[model samples]
Target: MRTFEYRLRPTKAQEQALMRTLLASRKMYNACLEDLITHYKETGKYLHLYEQDKHHGKEAHPDLPAVLVDTTLKRLHRSFTNFFRGLKEGRKIGFPRFKGATAWNTIQFRDAANCLDNGRFKAPLQCGGRMRVIVHRPLEGTFKFARIVLRPSGWYLQCVCETPPHPLLKKENAVGLDMGIRYLVADSNGHIIDNPKHARKTAKRLAHAQRNLARCKKGSHRRKKAKKKVARLHEHIANQRKDTLHKASRSYVDGYQTIAVEDLQVSNMVRNHCLAFVIADASWGMFRQYLEAKAESAGRQVIAVRPHYTSQTCSQCGESVEKSLSVRTHVCPFCGYIADRDENAARNILQRGLQVLARTGPSSSRREGPEQSGESPSVLKREAAGL
Candidate 1:
């Protein structure tokens, strides 16, 4: 399934209706959460969705439709489920919490049949009622569901649709990418894409807006206006960052049949306070996500290999050469080879990815039979490990 998002233009009355529905949904979410906590505290046992529904199944929220209520409750239940899963996986995750009025901004409609009529939005008409939508591109495939999202800029609709893969003919069959804050992407092909620091560019504007917001009296009209301005600035930066990532990922998918990249633990990487802000602005994670998603629809492959020593090991000599993060170039003593640090890393990533593909993926022909090969990869691995 793929998602397509479009701009929504709702009238003032419709906008009020949308706000009211969102508020109602938030209230319902909070009420359900309170009940769960109360029940758990009293019984010392947790209540799942069904049990909670049984307890308050008869309650009616006029503004919140039945479909909307189910979606909201399921979302709350899913949050708890995720929290438990995170605990089991030893991840840092907090328990489910109540949603504030501003926090809850999405309403999903489960029954999504004929969501569009003559290229106009039609789903969940009771709330916003057939609003004007820009269908910039033709949507292909069966409609699944519609998600209404309220952003600082305006309202938007996300349509999830089931579509078959549209494969493109491959050229430049494989390449690896080294992602970094300085350069967004450096490929094994020696191509480099500079990182566009959207947040940094707009930092001054954001700071000024935040200062204005802080000076405004709390709950005053000026405060609200200032807050919205800050939010819009933030949204603009996010959109700019997302746009760059999408274009870069799309180019990679279109140019390469197989894309290899480091399986970076971004959560761990962000712990370094000095580089955290820059790293977040770089958005390496979003780039990978876009690459994988686009590759899937295009019938291409994405290989994520371990990022342990790609930067330290020599791509030409296969020898370990440790260097500080400050080093911008790689010079191998053993092989007398020299190259850009990120390019060497990209080469190493591609080589490692090909090795992985040989071992596991059926698409690769790198693995030869025992009768045809001189030695197996396991023999070399064992020799390298001195085992």
Candidate 2:
């Protein structure tokens, strides 16, 4: 299934209505959670939606609208189903909990029939006529779903549709990548791509906007305007980062049939206070996600290798060399080889990826190997395969 996301431009009144809808949804979710807990405590059994609906539908809570009450109950049912599924799979608790003020701001609604195809997307409210939506991408598949999300900038709709599985491409060449903060990516062929540092470049503008936002009074008109200005700055930074990632990922995918990258623990990396900003700004997680989706569409294979000792082990000599983060150059005493630290790491990543592909056999007719300096047949195959 292909998913499409659209930027929504709601009028003032429509925006208020949307906010109210979100608030109502949040309230309903919390109330349902409370009811479930109460029922479980009293009867030693969980109450199903039909049973909860009978009780809630009969009692009138003056604060909540009838529509909101119904929606919330259904949401609770879905949440319960998900919670049980997660539990069965040894996942952490997935119950819907009460959202506080800070959390409430992030609350959103995911429901069916809210998609563009249903024509029910434009809802009438006090602030405006029908809500207008701009479709960013076309949807594909049978079942359609929509998510009303709250972002730092504003609200958006993500429409998702399920479709047939994509066909695999018939290509053989593969490349492995080692991503790092200093160098954006290193490949098996000793190629190193420099980090753009998009966030660092815009830090000054972001700081200025943030200072303005901090000085404004809470809930005041000036404060809201200042907050939006800061948010816009953030959006710009994010866009710049995403643009760089798209270009890099596209180039890699277009050049190789199979792409291998290390499965990094970004959350663990962020735990280090000193490296948190750099890690977050690098956005390796988001880059990998983009690569996966793009590769899927292009019928290429994306492999993730275990990251253990990838940097410390010498690719040529197969010997361990301890080096601190401060080391910029890799000098392997065992092999008498010298290279830039990042370039060496990238070559190791490429070798690991090729090893994995070799085990799977050639899914595509193209062979995964090093580019020969003067091999005409190999060069022709690489060109025909778009590598």
Best by TM-score: 1
Q: For residues 1-387, what per-residue lDDT tens digits would candidate 2 score against the true structure? A: 666667777777778777776676577678778888998999999898898788776255444445556666776688788889879975556577676544654322345534464333534232133555676556677645655566777776667777775655466677778776556677777777665666666767888888989999999999988988887787777777787788889888788888878766453342333322443435777888878877777778787666656667787887998786667688999998787776776667667777867687534222233331122212112222331
* Residue pair clashes in candidate 2: 13-127, 186-346, 187-346, 188-347
Count clashing residue pairs per candidate: 0, 4
User: In angstroms, what RMSD does candidate 2 have relative to the true structure?
Assistant: 9.2
Q: Write the per-residue lDDT of candidate 1 for residues 1-387, one digit (tens) a residue.
A: 888898888889888888888888889889999888998999998898887776544257666667787888889999999999989987767999888776889988886752766767775655867777888887779888888899999999898999988888866578989886567789998899886766566767888998899999988999989999999998888787898889999998999888888776554432333333444434867888888888888878888777667888999989999886667799999999899989998999999888877788735222222232222112112222331
- What are the models' TM-scores? 0.86, 0.75
* Stretch of 10 with least lDDT, candidate 2: 372-381
What clash pairs does model 1 have? none
